[model samples]
Target chain A: MIDFAFFLEIIPVLLAGLPLTLLLTTASMVIGFFLALLLALAQQGNRRIVIWPIRAFVAVFRGTPLLVQIFLIYYGLGQFRPSLQAIGIWWLFREPYWCAIVALSLNEAAYGSEILRGAIKAVPRGLTEAATASGMSKLLTLRLIVLPLALRNAIPNYTNEIILMVKGTSLASIITLMEITGIAQGLISQTYRAVEVFVAAGAIYLALNFAIISALNALETRLTPYRVRA
Target chain B: MTNIMHILGFQQGGWGAALLAASSVTLALSVLGFILGAALGATAAAGRLSPRRVPAWLAHVYGTVFRGVPDLLTIYLLYYGGSIALTQIGTLFGSDGFVGLPTFATGVLAIGIISGAYQGEVYRGAYQAVDRGQFEACKALGLSRYQSLRLVIVPQLMRHALPGLGNVWQLVLKDSALISVIGLVELMRQAQIGAGSTREPFIFYVAAAALYFVIAVVTASVFRFSEARAWRGMVHA
Candidate 1:
């Protein structure tokens, strides 16, 4: 039997973890977006040094599972504690929160860079030429004209990546962060009511994703008035 | 490099065999789930394309709910809730005992359900791309509904759907790593156990990651080869 009262009771308990989930998603996304921009731009250059390493990094991240990446960063990197300690950033890797964030950010960077690179490539050559004809430097053209247009084009795919990261934050629970899924796992152990508790937890995620989807749609519509149906 | 080989070696104390076995589990999980998903996806696609209002709306809801949610959460729900639902269904047949789904079955079902949503979209798109004239031609031939779909629509849909389905296969393969949470002895979980006992997290995880890469790259090429064959002689269309 479905228990409405029990579902209602767990909603507050689960919502307590909502902040951590939101924090993980937002922090990683903001950091990841900037890193993605760097990675995307690095490949546009003629130098193999920058492009090869970034390309390799993106491929490794995209090719493997995120869970493996998390383990590699969280547990595997911890094995090199002495070297990490020597580098003076061991303190960051020592904490599960930072490890989770780093893993998530790196994964996002991989996917986002590709999305951005595609968007940048898809930008019309004439637009960049027009920018150059207006007497702007290459850097100035990229900054003023190219990057903005690529960003607008990248929004839909980037929105998907963001939604993926939001779902991805649930992995943080595995490293002992009590995010929504982690909290649900805990509640199931305590109450022995897996179905009811998970149903409630799923509803919260459904609501969260619904908000994201609607916001992204609105932004997509607002930015692309040209896409409006006749 | 010698040290790396020692860690990855298959002899007594090495993780190579365990890692390989786990890779098979991962492959089987992905393939079986994809098969089930393809079937479900076809159904959902049909529902969405149906003229009937309810089935179309339900299919839309199915796609929205599965696609919008995190796959990790979906797997967890199925892992825990599926067994209970099974037990309840058992009760109607006078069975009183708890009916449980093994971790593998549960994982497969979860992957199937999640991938089905994406597959549905791919099928629907492919269905849309099937020339409208093809359907009319089928009707003109006095073909039955089922025969029309079989004789005319499906072959073209398969051609268009191959790439999208390939993408979904990669996703499901990566997502299979999540089944580790429920203690399935798939590659990721095996890596976790090997790493924990060996205290060589770097070696085991790196090995696991390498295996995943090999599987992904190889399978992707397979998809590409098949896709090429599928598109052969159809370029002008």
Candidate 2:
């Protein structure tokens, strides 16, 4: 008994939220990627003082649910508004959009750093040793030899993280961001056609993820030209 | 510090008891959802592995659609759509009014279906990872399919699936938090209520996060223990 016409009609409405969803995903992924790189690089050193704090950060973020993280950032931070204002950075915490971005980015960083760290560790040690033997410094060995291989290795896994971030963007709706899920929720309230509206919304997400998967697959093929095809 | 304790404490005005009760609800919801998911996952895995084309295609579609879409959207769809569908079914049976599903039931159903999709992949992978020779030996020993599956294949499959299942369990536990949006009064929802009533969101949320972390850590250790036991007497390469 689904209204086919209604399903077609809501596509344009849901598409309106596409730009914000893309923005949230891209912005958080970019920020999170850099933070994750920094974290992974820091952990390359065996210093307990440095790695312990990062380990704790990853454990806490990965252990708790992202919804709790979002609520903690948005409403919980309001509890410390005066102190934040005094510190001159209350502007970042003031908007729900910013709060969502912060939480999403932090969450992505925890997961992404682990993926990147594993990739980095998987790089062949002989290659790096050979690079160092050829008059390259440790920094050069990492930059010229280790990083490229690790990044290529990391792409397949990072694609999953990216898809996850795209999915994670839907949670922004809960904090009133007017994203796809937000608009769909609004439409459902008005029309009481939850199934149709959600089906349309889910279609949009499915399309987005499919595109992402294809692009990453293409990237993986392009980067690993040396890979043997079975 | 004392004020923080007073608010979270088990005293008259404290929210400790309420939060504790809500955590139990969260645990129950997740455990039930996970068990349901495991059953669905096994069925879906069987479908995927079947020689028939239709079931394999249907199972593939289920995995792709569920895995691609957000869990929040699925929960919302089920929460809103279930009642509507139920009412229509009720009307067909001559029972008139809107037949709404309870929030807890909806939550469990949502989590079950979503986790089932992921668990299907885990089970399929584990099935493939079972050594080919074992199956050959089972056939050579003149064992029937059901007997071999029950006695030989399934145990090894469970052993291989343990790590993946542990991951899915954590995912299901975390997803139970989203059930709060539908107002199930679990840990997340209880924290929200306490935050609103007491106007102390930071404390309540921090406390809630700690509780979730503890649960995750404890369950993880249990999985690790079982994994170690499962690996007992096995030779490692």
Candidate 3:
């Protein structure tokens, strides 16, 4: 009745696939951060052209489910094989890994842009005005004052976004990416013991998220030393 | 554009009708799950706020475990485990051997459990947001607890809870896609089926995404309108 041997066999296999999950999360977060930063910065000075398009883009990306987005990017785009081949980008489009990354990064950019915008808004107007009065150039003000404060303020929201990305990476499994959950599903097909294998996968995901949370919390404390002192 | 239109058309080969039906199923599942979650959430939220030891402990465990794990695992467990549990129950009740569990029921159960975890937090937060002084005032006026709750606490809690509940509904809607893995013919599953059958993965998947986008945008606007109406008289900065 016991399946201790089965558990032993699957744990290592599932762990092997965790790196892809982590890689997707990290790469997408980094890429999304840059894209989000650019969008957030662009939305600052312009309300007519730049802001509207970004707003629409963010709304579409954030409003819908990640599963739909992933399917659209992976299977949906695969329908354009001929066009992609014509454009010489079929190699990239043909791979599920690239599709997963693209979907995750675009999703994160929408959310990260919102967080960045909020952080920018939270920056006290008085400080920005004082910088302006002090003859600090716009670029210098952004580098020295605006970004540091915004980054500090955005830490909590960003942590939420990061953990969400970690969870969202599991959706890649639907597209045949053998991440942790995908491997777990495979194990279930092999063993027919749903509870134990899922529990193992859940434990893995929870452990990873827990580590991220603790690290982010420490970063938050380090970034806001005043809070630690208080 | 012509190819896109033809693939999405209502012809025998087209997936538009099938995907649309699946979207309806997704909507139905979300509503069912949201309602189920609200009931459980209310109970859990009350238990959490109760001045008792046992209920608080139960509530604590439920919240912690459900919130800590990924929703996908929760869904997978429900989808696979649900049939096993249901078949056992059916046999116990003297039904035919191996009573089947539909994917829709399984999907609803999964979505409900996950949404309940979130709804519990929302209700708990909303309960805390209810002004304590009003309860005191109602008591001063000699209103019974049920009457006071029905007249005062419930309305305020519902208003504050609306936005959070709306958020959980959207979350539930999106998460319904996960149930497709269990072979539920929801939107994503339908899209997958269309992709395989038509060999037009790109067209079908994009259409599915667009359908989801439309639903999300419309529902979000409705929730926003309700929030505005609910808080019409109150001043919020």
Candidate 4:
């Protein structure tokens, strides 16, 4: 009673959700990268006032689950429509797409910042001193020496985070976005073939992650030529 | 004020008790899932390390596929496929019926499957961290493979693996929230019920987040304590 034909049929329907999934992953990751840089930079500062709040923010975001954050943004904030409308920013929260992107980007930013911080901290202090001795300004030294090394160190972990974001977007289905998991759920109820439909959906995710992982692997190899065997 | 009192009350029309009870259930689900995952993980670690080809390949496939796929889909698959598999198994035993598993069992099954993939990597890495010279010493001492593993390998492997396991534990706790979609009355599901009933999604969701945070912090303290114990009597441990 196993149906290969049904598996074949659901592939196209699930792929329909792929664009939104990719869009959400790409958009949130891009936004998340900038926010994370801000966060990482903020935490690197000396001011206690600046440090404590950002520390708390990162801890709160990281400590809780992404599902909770999504619900808070979507349903919880949806409860405060009048207040938001009065504040003139209700339009952003009005759409589920925007809500998911906001929640996901926030969550990704928290983790991405941690990764960025670790990679930056791992850079050798002597390298910076040498660059300074060579008469480079702090900004030029940071651009030429520090970030490139940190980014190279960060590629693998950031790639892992992106894969995680791809998986995380599936939760957007709970809030009524018709992404892969969402469409898969619809098909399961309609077709009564849960196993096959989910298999197809899972395969789609696996393929997406594989493509991303391979691309990152190529980039990692390019960045760290010495680490590779000839 | 009355509505807040009613919501916070332990008596009739209140959800404080329900939410707290569900939090305990959430803890139980995570522990059970983690234990089940540890068992599967141990088997997978052995399989991957085995000299045989098939078990190694099978374990590799299991780890990759489970880790690569989204966990929510795994839960959904188990929820639906479990009953189907159970029903068919029951029919061969002359019972024509729906052998439905409780939601908690299904949730554990999903978490176990997902966490097993991760824990296998942790165990394999820990095993590799054990000095190769130590294993040769055991062989030179004429110790049986089982005795060497029990005496020399397992303890150090566990010590090395403690931090990684701590991470997997946190992952399990958060992943348990995903089980709520299957109608399990865990913290997230309880919050959903309250939010839906009260139309105050903010309070319930925030309350849920708080509870999750408290549990995570407390559990982390326990892990830290255990790690400290595991590292005792070392030069820099």
The candidate scoring highest on DockQ is: 2
Q: Candidate 1 lDDT, tens digit per residue, A90-152?
A: 999999999999999989999999999999999999999998889999999999888988998
Measured by TM-score, how close is model 1 to the native structure? 0.94
Candidate 2 per-residue C-alpha lDDT over A96-140 given as tens digits, one digit per residue, 9 for 90 to 100:
999999999999999989999999999999998899779899899
Lowest summed lDDT across 10 adjacent residues in model 4 chain A is found at A185-194
Among the numbered candidates, top TM-score falls to: 2
Tell me which of candidates 1 and 2 scores higher on TM-score. Answer: 2
- Expressed as tens digits, the lDDT of each residue in B101-130 for candidate 3 is 688887887788788888999999998999
Better of 1 and 3 by DockQ: 1
In model 1, how large is the Cα lDDT of residue B56?
100
Q: Candidates 3 and 4: which is better by DockQ?
A: 4
- Winner on DockQ (2 vs 3): 2
- Fraction of native Cα contacts kept in each candidate? 0.72, 0.75, 0.64, 0.65
The reply for model 2, stretches above 4 Å from the true place, is A228-230, B87-99
For each candidate in turn, the TM-score is: 0.94, 0.97, 0.92, 0.95
Residue B97, model 2, lDDT: 82
Model 3, global lDDT: 0.85
lDDT of 2 at B22: 96
Error of 1 at A94 (Å): 1.1
The weakest ten consecutive residues by lDDT in model 3 chain A span A185-194
Alpha-carbon DockQ of candidate 2: 0.82
